[model samples]
Target: METSVFTRSIESLLDEDEYRALQTHLVENPESGSIIPGSGGIRKIRWGLKGRGKRGGARVVYFWAVRRDRILMLYA
Candidate 1:
């Protein structure tokens, strides 16, 4: 639920519906992504773009703040 200006700008690259879907999925499964090495607890997920498979989709980097039940979307 928290994002920086850069993150917001990066998210704008996604279609509106795709962005919403990503948000909903993250809210429901904050731990869905695997922890990224050398980056604290930041995680990354492979999000499929429209008409593209995982191999060609975007990588969404985020941090889950469990205590606050919030996800800090960092990049996409």
Candidate 2:
């Protein structure tokens, strides 16, 4: 996980709709651990989604980049 990349992603810069979507995800699937691909020029990268609501239920996503360096991060 790249700190800079995770800190600077579209998911990191959640808009009104995106924030609601995340909250919905947390509510719906309260016990799932998964990783989904991130968007916006962040190929070769995947964001980790971990549920921490019920002793690791109800997930949150952390966007990450796969580059060797942190210069490629682009926050939306």
Candidate with top TM-score is 1
Tens-digit lDDT track of model 2 for 1-76: 3245544555544555754665455345432324444544332222233432344322234333335322222322
Off by over 4 Å in 1: 2-12
Report the lDDT of model 2 for residue 63.
32
User: Which tens-of-lDDT digit does each residue in 1-76 have in candidate 1?
Assistant: 5557536665666777888898899999989999999988999999888888878888888999888778888877
Q: Estimate each model's TM-score.
A: 0.84, 0.29
Candidate 2 — which residues are off by over 4 angstroms?
A: 1-12, 34-76
* Candidate 2 residue pairs in clash (backbone atoms < 3 Å): 30-58, 51-59
**What TM-score does prediction 2 earn?**
0.29
Q: RMSDs, each prediction? A: 1.8, 11.6
Q: For candidate 1, what is the lDDT?
A: 0.83
